[model samples]
Target: MGKSPDIIKDTSETLKPVSGRGITVMQGWYDKNIKACHVTLWDLGETDDNFSDDDAEGVTLSVQVTIFSQEDEVELAREIKSLMKADGFSFEGRNGDDSEPEDGIYMKAQRFSKFYESEE
Candidate 1:
């Protein structure tokens, strides 16, 4: 029921408490120049929706997260995934490719989707 931007904002905020220590949380893409631990969120698409005058239900959406770090960030990723799961989001799946764009930047990513219900 929540809009894509709203969901993204919530996700970013949820991750904010864990941010710092050379890591940053952001909605959408982060600046490309600074090569540190960065977390970016994106709304991929809508899956389905069931709505009435009183409420909106079964509304699902896909979200993408890209992590850039100098070393392995599995723990950080897991923390994020756990946070999302605990926040009532469903884990759709994830990708296994990690990249080093330039020299010390290690990049990893995950994708998830969840259904939301809200009063309308």
Candidate 2:
């Protein structure tokens, strides 16, 4: 269970794709209350593509996201999970980020705003 959905909507809209060597994503989540999220990403060492044999080479990126109290942490988490499951969150192949594959996709994120609009 979490505090509220409002509290999870005041963070940064800057979901800039971070790419480089030694970066690692530790956690990721959406908070309902406070209107914000905590994306915990880290930068580790790097390896050559020949040795790593991974997708990207040289620089890598990873992050962790955390949201504060809400009605249901599990439910909220599920929603976030579903979104990431999808392929097209933003414009694909727009930049260094990879585009969604031709495979099927699903939406996990609920219509939760990560920020609040002042009473006009």
Candidate 3:
């Protein structure tokens, strides 16, 4: 099985504290009606066990986290970076400059990566 579900669950749990007041932490996509912290995952590659080349060992994945808010998002973005890092993700950096996609909503995206060892 893929580690997608585990990653998503960990992300949701890590960001749950910031999930009220019309804002939410979601996987894959977000609702435009409210503020959101959206997470998208991509499997980058896999590694083989060092001892035996035939056995799969782990996978590396890239996680894109985008935050959309009706207010300034710098503080929230920093908080998210800290939280995700504490949860074992290595911060890769911001994906792009912050932008206002609509009249009042602001958006910022960041990248992170993690390696998950295969389950026996």
**Poorest stretch of ten by lDDT in candidate 1:** 1-10
Candidate 2 vs candidate 3, TM-score winner: 3
- Candidates 2 and 3 compared by lDDT, better number: 3
After superposition, the stretches of candidate 1 with alpha carbons farther than 4 Å from their true spots are 1-5, 20-22, 50-56, 99-103, 118-120
Candidate 1: lDDT of 102? 63
**Model 3 spans > 4 angstroms off:** 1-5, 20-22, 35-54, 99-102
Q: Which lDDT tens digits does candidate 1 get at residues 43-73?
A: 8877556866655566677788878777878
Segments in model 2 whose C-alpha atoms lie over 4 Å from true places: 1-58, 88-120
Q: Using TM-score as the measure, what is the rank order of every candidate, best first?
A: 1, 3, 2
lDDT of 3 by residue, 21-84 (tens): 4356767644665544443333333333434567656665666777766665888789889988
Q: What TM-score, over all chains together, does every model reach?
A: 0.76, 0.29, 0.71
Tens-place lDDT digits, model 2, residues 18-49:
11222222234432232322333212222223
**Cα distance off (Å), candidate 1, residue 102:** 6.4
